[model samples]
Target: MAEKAKVYFTDFRCPSWRENLPQKLARLMMTAGFGDIEMEGKYVAVKMHFGEPGNLAFLRHNWARVVVDLVKSQGGKPFLTDCNTLYVGGRKNALDHIESAYLNGFNPYATGCHILIGDGLKGTDEVEVPVEGGEYVTAAKIGRAIMDADVFVSLTHFKGHEQAGMGGCLKNIGMGCGSRAGKMEMHSAGKPYVKEKKCVGCHACAKICAHGAPVIENGKCAIDQNKCVGCGRCLGVCPKDAIEAANDEAPDILNKKIAEYTKAVVAGRPCFHVSLVQDISPNCDCHGENDAPIAPDIGMFASFDPVALDQACADAVAAQKPLPGSVLFDKDSGCDCGRDDLLYANHPDTDWKVCVEHGEKIGIGTRQYELVKI
Candidate 1:
């Protein structure tokens, strides 16, 4: 049997004379061996989701400030970062992504660090990284800025996800660090297609493609599937946003790909993960609107092993009763929920365990963990 990884936890309860939640979180991270990492004058990529516009359940900037301060104390140049979305949204481009992040109060004044959209403007900047021991993807197209970092740290908001089951440390680093093209590859096995009505005969796609995939005629563009390599470059350069990725990958494969992508990002790097199990929304922060929390606020968790950290957080959530007025509670009240897994109860179509199991299989970290309360 593999030795269990240690995951540190702390509750939200704070006495008037005692330290607050943020302070407690800092202590928890320290206890989890965050200070032991060699971070003297290194560029640390603090990967996290800047909630989509109108999503109120996303993590607040105050929590980020605590992380920023900790990184600074260790002489690490930390920056908050997330890649642009593959779908059309407020964060589809670098300019819009920064705007949305600022709109959500992740400004430098609040978080005490600069915000760098992982992918450059238009979500095209990327570095092809080879995923060792990967069965789904061999090379993952990760954001150039994220790949340039000397250290990687994930600050995740643990929540229910419609596709990947649960949004935890792996979700934050893997999917969040991928460039737009990377996201396309993970979400779809098919190549991108052009909306003839939306295409303005820009020929921009043709110009960007090394392969002659974009065929143009009659003021319209279409991807030639035979020639298309699915690099997803055309999707970024099209001025009219006419091209769209086919998000047809199954949930199980998507989860496995997420694990592989995470392996590519964290391999041969000093990494630490922190997840706050509060505002357990039933959907991702990528959603413009958030539903009520599925479970009550649990606490914060920190560990060197992201897989173990996620497993610990998920187990913590599984132990909680569903929050009243939430979708999970509604399902439980209606009939037998069958399982104690709150994430699955919230989104029955998804199984959060797949990602962690794959992560362990890929040598990222073990799912077995010893949760130490702080």
Candidate 2:
């Protein structure tokens, strides 16, 4: 069998044809062997990060519009989706999540689609998918709307991530699709504790804690270790910086869990992936604001294999030279001789290979791919 090839089209030399984006993407899909009716009449869930309110650099609605139109032209009914956040601010509830999506220019007529919060109200509506992976033990929780979709497409804004090395297709689907409690499970392997110095007895944590494990004792709210289940609910709501996750130096474990969660989200679905290498923020778009991009707008990639798509996207981005006046303006950090320009320039400590390798090991997709340019 031939190796799967990832389709690539750069942001360069594509400005004049901006209005033809829908037809362009449709033609690309045709070349990839997808018919218009294949997407037509299907519940095409276009999974994407609408981005936090304060974050400026995110996937544009024009791109999503192109995708929605293509799905429609092919007879697919498309709807934009993202799960409720684990954080305490905006998008924690369905109403606020919808409002955030609207504020981000994803209104019904704008993107030629409707927006739905993947996990229902309060971030609790989810179905647990059973997987026999040794590390995952019981199962992983995924958003029901995503689970029920006839077809799925993860359109990710690829960028640097502090914890996962990079946020590509796998991170976009795994961590992106997880409900709040599911996210709690992924991050809960380590226990959370209260820092006495930062604990101001604000009682926010106490209010959100379901078990009442945190009680005001001696003028300070304290977490009863015995009663605490490490659910992480209190940690997210804690106004004071008292509650924090324990040291988790095991990145490999975290990567594996992310992969398993991604599996749960896309299990048995005809899924596709697209990663845009523009405005590559250092932290996730979950943050309120995005720092300058480390590189110029690179390109867009598409593939049937999420893992290979991500790996290919990373390789393409890492081959580019860093743009001056961006986050990685300095060139002499530590390039001994011939190093990967993008990786070495943007972040010297991170290794993106881990995400692709782990993803491949779990049968997410093969790293081998051909670069078919559109």
Candidate 3:
């Protein structure tokens, strides 16, 4: 049997004389062996989500300052990063993405580090990395900037996810690091298509595609499926936001792909992970608006093994009772309020275990863990 990975945990309790939560988080990270990494003069990519415009559940910049300060203390050059979103939102492109991040209070002044959108201006700048033991994706399209970093660190906000059951470390790293095309590949088996009503025949997509996928006719645009390569460049340049990817991939396969993409990211790097199990929202922070939290704040977690960290977090969430007014407790008369698996009870169709199981199968990390309290 594989040895259990050590996961460090610290609750959000502080007296007037005690250290603050951020300082305690820094201590938790050090206890998890974050200080052991050789970080002198290396570029460290701190991967995290800059919440959507109106989402209040996302991690505050104060939490990121802890990681940034620690990295700087070790002489590591750190920068915050997250790839552009596949969906049409505040974070689809670099400029708008930065604006949204700033709008959500993740500016350099707040986080004590610069923000780099992993993909370039249009979400097309990517590096095709070969997934060593991948079953679904052979070559995962990761963001160029994220892959360029010498060290990777994930700062995740552990929460309930509608599609993947829970958005933990793996979700934050795998789905977060993938380029637009990578996201499309994981979410859909089919290529992108142009919506006729939204298409203005701007010919921007036609000009950008080397394959001549976008064809203009009758002052409207249509994508030729045979010629399209699914690079996802058209989605960024569409003035009318007409081009859209097909979300046809099954939930299980999507979870597997997320695991595969995560393998492509942290396979050969010095990686560390930290998760704050607070504001356990029902949906992703990608939503423009955030609903009430499903559970009360549990605490913070840190680990060298992301898989173990995620497993520990899932376990912690499972131990909590549902918040009365949240969706988990009010899902109708058939709601399983007493269910031990809160994540599954919240989203019955999604199984969060699939991602971790696939992650372990792909040789990233094991799900078994020993929680060490600080």
Candidate 4:
């Protein structure tokens, strides 16, 4: 058996006289050995999600400010970053992505760090990273800017997810850091398809596709799977949202792929992870709107082992009863089965355990942890 990883935790409560949430968060991070990283003069990428426009559940700029300050204190150059979305959204391009971050109060003045859209303007900038011992992904297409960083830090918002069961440290660093093509590879089995009703045959997808997979027939476009390398460029260029990536991968595979991508990012780099289990929303922040939290705010967790940190958080959330008016509470209240499995209860189609298990299997970290409360 392996030794347990140490996961440091703290509740949201702060005494009126002492430190505020941000200051307390700083203390929590320091206590968890964040300052031990040799960040002197290194380029540290602070990967995080700048929530989709209209989704108010994303982490506040204040949280990022604390992290930026910490990095600066350690003489590291830090930047806030996330890759362009594969789907049509405010953050599909670099210009729009920066604007979305700025609009969401993540401006340089607010977070004390410049924002860099991980993938380039059109979501094509990428670096192929070979995943060591990867089962699902041989190589991961990561954003070039993220791969260029000397050190990596994941500032994650822990919450329930519609697909991966739970969006925690691994999801934030893995799925969030992938380039558009990389995202498509993880979510789909093969290629994308055109929604006939939504296709206008404008040739937008074909114009951007280097593979020429989008062929026009009868004034509508259909992707030629044989010609397609699953680059996912067509999905972004389609104005009508007609081209959709295949969502055929089973939940377990999706989770494993996420773990593999995570390995690609952190494999030869110094990394630290921090997850604030607040805004316990029922879906990923990628959604245009966020649902109410299924549970009350838990706390902040920090660790060098992302798998252990995530497992600790999942355990914490599982122990609590769902909030009175939350969607999970409503559903569980009407059922005879227990609601202890709050994450699965929130999204039945996904098994959050698969991600952590695979993450441990790949030598990222251990799920067995000693939760040290502060």
Superposed by TM-score, candidate 1 places the C-alpha of residue 369 at a distance from the truth, in angstroms, of 0.5
Give me the overall lDDT of model 4. Answer: 0.91
Alpha-carbon local distance difference test for all models: 0.91, 0.75, 0.91, 0.91
Candidate number that wins on TM-score, 3 or 4: 3
TM-score of each: 0.96, 0.85, 0.98, 0.96
TM-score for predicted model 3 compared with the true structure? 0.98
Candidate ranking under lDDT, highest first, comes to 3, 4, 1, 2
> What TM value does model 2 have?
0.85
Candidate 4 local lDDT, 1-374, one digit each (tens): 99999999999998686789999999999999999999999999999999999999999999999999999999999999999987778898899899998889999999998988888887789999999999989999999999999999999999999999999999998999999899999998989989899999999998988888889998999999899999888877788889888888899999999999999999988999999999999899999999889889989999999999999999887666788788977775422235457787788778899999999999999999999899
Clashing pairs in 3: none
Give the per-residue lDDT digits (tens) of candidate 3, residues 1-374.
Answer: 99999999989998856788888899899988999999999999999999998899999999999999999999999999999998889999999999999988889999899999998999988999999989999999999999999999999999988788899999999999999999999999999998898888889999999999899999998889899989999999988889999999989999999999999999998999999999999889999988898888999999989889999999888777778898867875233545567777778888898999999999999999999998
Model 4 root mean square deviation, Cα atoms: 1.5
Candidate closer to the true structure by lDDT (higher is better), 1 or 3: 3
How far does residue 88 in candidate 4 sit from its true spot (Å)? 2.4
Q: Where is model 1 more than 4 Å wrong at Cα?
A: 333-337
Encode model 2's per-residue lDDT on 1-374: one tens digit a residue: 64675665544344675546555665565565555236656899899999889998888787898778778878898899998776555677788888987898889889998987887776666888875452552688778888778998888999877777778888889888877667766655655677888788888888888887898877677778788876566755666557765645455666677888887777686887777888887678888889888766776777788888887878876776666666666554432425754654455565667767776777777888888887
Better of 1 and 4 by lDDT: 4
